[model samples]
Target: MIKQILPSEVVAVDVREDPPEATLFPEEEALVAAAVEKRRREFRTVRHCARLALAELDVPPSPLLRGERGAPIWPAGIVGSMTHCAGYRAAAVGRSEVVSTIGIDAEPHDRLPDGVLDAVSLPAERVRHAALAGADATVHWDRILFSAKESVYKAWFPLTGRWLGFEDADITIDAEAGAFQARLLVPGDTAEGLYLTGFAGRWLVQDGVVTTAIAVLR
Candidate 1:
């Protein structure tokens, strides 16, 4: 489902429920050695999906450690992201020669809890969501926008080593196009000679989940 939204060079794996078990590498086990059962399960499940994605690229599975901000550390020559939520887990990867960075996120297709949307969105974005909500009533536009912002932050942090607040990027979602564009309100960078003031990504809402992704070319 998410593959349709990403570039052809990227490979992805997704599972509806946690796998029965995952064989974690020694280093990876230490990362979650003290975690609760549920946390360990989620971590292992997403990592399992990631290894499958790496295998698709003909790269052998390796230990994926967590960075300072809890982002997955992919092997050299690879760029990827992993996400998991209730009933869903997914991973996406691409070769660095073709992709400078990639970020993917999945969220339950439901309204933001109470006032959570206000915290995650700009006033203008909320207005846009209102109009969209009335038209395409099938998808949760607010949640999708939130997911897009997450993708933006994940991709941006890996490049700039800077924090991107929820309000730092103004996102515009085009439901008809099944895409969104995030215009950076802060400083941007050049990826592979392309000056990126913004990132354009694809999104999909399906089977009670919303997935968004961005792949910067190198």
Candidate 2:
């Protein structure tokens, strides 16, 4: 489902169940050893997916260490993102030359908890969500919107090394086309230069899950 929304050059690996043979390297093990069992399992499983994605790009399975902000530090010349949710874990990667930055997120097909919509979205976004929900009550658009903002922030932070609150990006969702756009209300820099505008992305709700992805080329 996620692969359908990413660029052709991007390789995405997804797993619905934990990889039976997954194992973390020494460094990775140290980072999560103190974590709870569930956290350790999810971390190893997602990293397994990441390794598979990198392998698809002909890159070896190198140690994926977390940066200062807890973001994965990719190997040189590679740009990628990873996400995991209930029963879903995935990672997408591409050559840095092809994709300067990328972000992907997954969430269960469920409504946000009470008041979360108001807290994470602007007034206009809530209005749009109400309209969308009225038209199609089957899928949870609010959660999808939240996931989209997460992807945007993941992509934004790598380039700018700064924080992007949910309210910082005004997102417009096009349910009919299964797409969305985000207008950045703050300034940020990209590999091409400073990009204070926005980002275009693709989204999908399938198999009881909502997935969103954004890929920015140089």
Candidate 3:
């Protein structure tokens, strides 16, 4: 379980049942009927994890449909994101205005695949990697940075109607407090000057599991 304390309100959550196997949706969601049986099952797991996450909100779960920009809308007024790996399923949710946006993700804790930093980390962050040659610090920092970028996107994308690459935001991780921070670099097509001053929460990487959450604030 994790709690994301923002300036307005806090979002609390727990990781739920993870699919025993990898799940993937068909490229053609509209023609799901023609999808392979295994593909259909994967889609079901995605929907189920999403719904279960929303259950933590004050709003009752309803059919959540994706908008043109890929944001989700539920009958109840809330926004969130959920992701599950072979062994973990996680979600983050918040009510609008009162709360901006929330995203949660889980990954297995193995040495991050080599060279992913090029795609997922900022130039300055990459320097940190260079400095921590043999320390656990470097590896965990890499994970937190990757996680922060993902959370920022989930929080920003729905409201802005645009997508942000990992390089679009600069991230800072506070290891002792178990929290992280982010700042907009390009701001791009997002709300101008919409600075992400801070993101506070807990993250754990143990026994081959890595989980984190982020909640946007006022």
Candidate 4:
């Protein structure tokens, strides 16, 4: 499920399983044992990714547990984030020393559902974003917005010990650079208000799948 994209400084991974394979943890099995087939399959996908990561670090293949609010926490000093969807799964790891905030997201290369854009973006955001990224933009605006929010959650939770909503961060895609710049509207008391220094985003569309990464500045 993981393909190392960034060097050791930033680790990125991707998975290709409907509903993903790394969602299950040992503790969740009992609760979900009687769940429908679809849910069980999804859990298997997520746990596979998590277990592979633990094994690589020589840890047991037990389920990767989540703390309050579903934040994944591994034993000992490792810091990372887990992301899985209907089509893929991924995890980003940075040895506790250098990595500050890391986030990865995968979205299908499809059009936004009706009214979905309005729910995610305000009128001004929609206008400013298009101006910020004129023509020749290959990436879709809604996907960029959704991916940016996911990354923010992954990167911010560990640093701040707090939760942020989707409206907390905003993004402007830079087509020329093949990336996007994100601005943090509200970092909250976590990390002493981690204002947006900047976000280095990398986007890829492979075999009709769209995956993007937003590694928070150190």
Candidate 5:
């Protein structure tokens, strides 16, 4: 399902269950050693998916560690993102020469928790969400908006090494096209010399999950 939203340059792998064979490297285990069972399982399985995606690019498996802001430290020359939610875990990776950055997220297909919509969205976005919900009551636009912002931040941080607040970007959802665009409100240049302005991403709602992805090419 995650592969459906990402570009061909990216390699995506997803699984609905934790593979019993999935085991975290010692370093990774120590990172989650104090966490609850659920946290440990998700952490382990998500990395499992990440390694599979990396292997698709002929990259050898390595201990996927966390860096600034807890983002996964990918192998050199690789850009990737990982996300997990109830019953879903996925990872997407790409060669840095072909892809500059990648961000992906997944969430259960449900309404945002009370007050979460307002906290994570601009007023204009809320207005648009109302319009979308009024038109089609089947999809959860608020949750998708939150997930898109997450993807935007994930893609943004690796390039700029900065924190992007929920209000930092204005998201517009194109319900019919299964896509969204994020206009960055902050001003900065990416490390690669590109003026960081906005991002275009794709979203999908399927089989009780909502997934969003952004991949910026070099």
Candidate 6:
């Protein structure tokens, strides 16, 4: 399902069920030792999807840890992202030499909690959402808008190592094309000597889930 939105250079794996073989490393286990069963299950299953994606690139299985901001620390030369929602887990990875960053997120296909839409979105974005919703009332534009910002932040953080507030980027969605663009209100310089001003990504709504992804190539 996630692969439908990503480019061919990326390896995307998603699962609707928790695999029995999805075991966690001791380090990863320790991080979620005190959490409830649901937390543990999602965490373990998502890493399993990540490992499977990594293996496709000939990368050996290893402990996938987290760096600052809780982003998954991928194997060297790899850029990736992971997301899990009710009844779904997904991971997407790519060679860093070809892809600078990757961001992916999934959410249940439903409206945002009351006030969440205003909190996470800029006024212009909200106006756009209204226009979109008016055109096609079947889709949950607010949820997809939130997911797009999440993907934008996920793609932004690994390079800048900074926090991206929900209000930091303005998202524009193209409902017909199943695509979106995030224009950064606060641009930053990356370690790779690139100044990121915006990101273009794709979105999908299917089988009761909404997914968004961004992959920036070098």
**Which candidate has the highest lDDT of all?**
5
Clashes of 4: 12
Regions more than 4 Å wrong, model 5: none
TM-scores for all candidates: the values are: 0.95, 0.97, 0.74, 0.79, 0.99, 0.99
lDDT scores in order: 0.89, 0.92, 0.60, 0.63, 0.96, 0.95
Stretches of candidate 3 above 4 Å error?
Answer: 3-42, 56-58, 131-139, 188-202
Q: After superposing candidate 6, which stretches have Cα over 4 Å from the reference?
A: none
Candidate 2 per-residue lDDT over residues 1-218, each given as its tens digit: 79999989899999999978988999999999899988988999999999999998889988999995899999999989999999999999999888878999999999999999999999999999999999999989999999999999988988888889999999999998999999998876665577658999999989999999999877
Q: What is the lDDT of residue 61 in candidate 6?
A: 95
> What is the Å distance of residue 106 in model 4 from its true position?
1.3
Indicate the TM-score of model 3.
0.74
What number of clashing residue pairs does each candidate have, in the order they appear?
A: 0, 0, 0, 12, 0, 0
- Clash count (model 3, backbone only): 0
After superposition, candidate 1 runs with Cα above 4 Å error = 190-194
lDDT for model 3 comes to 0.60
Lowest summed lDDT window (length 10), candidate 3 = 22-31
Q: 133-169 in candidate 1: lDDT tens per residue?
A: 9998877898999899999988887787678899999
User: Which residue runs does candidate 2 get wrong by more than 4 Å?
Assistant: none
The collision pairs in model 6 are none
Quote the lDDT for 174 in model 3: 60
Where is model 6 poorest over a 10-residue stretch in terms of lDDT? Answer: 187-196
> Order of all candidates by lDDT, from best down to worst?
5, 6, 2, 1, 4, 3
Candidate 5: pairs in clash: none
